[model samples]
Target: MFSKLFKSQSALRRFYSTATQNLTEKQEPKTYYKITLLRSAIALPKRYKDTLVTLGIHRRMQTVFHPHKPDIAGKILRVKELVQVENVPASAVRTKTEQRWERRPDPGFEVVGTWKNKRWLLDEEGI
Candidate 1:
């Protein structure tokens, strides 16, 4: 049972890894900007709010991906104190739905050894 489970897990991992590589290759460049809003612009100057708007960040914790360019870099610098910025590949970017899905917790338990795989408990002394 354990072997079957392991084999399935490995297959899933392989499939996802290759799929991820394809996705990245098709959508992302070697380098890009990952901008996440860490602080809100409320009660701040108009410039900060305008900058955030220009960067396409609407609220706190919102993340936006942009290409690495002089104009974008300058905008980031201008609002450096209000946001967290990182250089990431296009593959790292996630849409709103994807981000929400990723934030969800796992269901907890999973089936492992089954009746057909009694060999999984071979080393156990008291079964």
Candidate 2:
């Protein structure tokens, strides 16, 4: 009975790993590391902050993308606890200007001759 259970567990593990592999194979290949800083490295060792600097992250919640290379992966692991990482395809990478445009707040509209504005003016005039 123990042999049967162990065999089943091994098979299940294999199935789980293969299923994830198949999904990745079907989807667009991940070529970039989307690294977003979630926590500050302040009060931590200088090495931690320096790793972030090397990765071009200066502020909390800042995101940067690097190619999926061994050295870049190592740097990411060094500060893994302070960041959120996602495997993104090359097309998902954006330029600095694009990121700024996406981050900027939407332009607001002017309230032109609305009923609320007219009511406010009349109220001030003792209407």
lDDT for each residue of candidate 2 in 21-70, tens digit (9 for 90 to 100): 89877686889999999999999999999999999999998889999999
State the lDDT of candidate 1 residue by residue for 1-127, as single tens digits.
9999999999999999999989968676657788999989899889989989999999999998888899999999999998998888877877778989999999898865677886557536445
Worst 10 residues of 1 by lDDT: 118-127
Tell me each candidate's TM-score: 0.58, 0.62
Off by over 4 Å in 1: 1-29, 108-127
Candidate 1 pairs with clashing backbones: 1-117
lDDT of each: 0.87, 0.92
Candidate 2: where are CA atoms >4 Å away? 1-27, 105-127
| Winning candidate number (lDDT) | 2
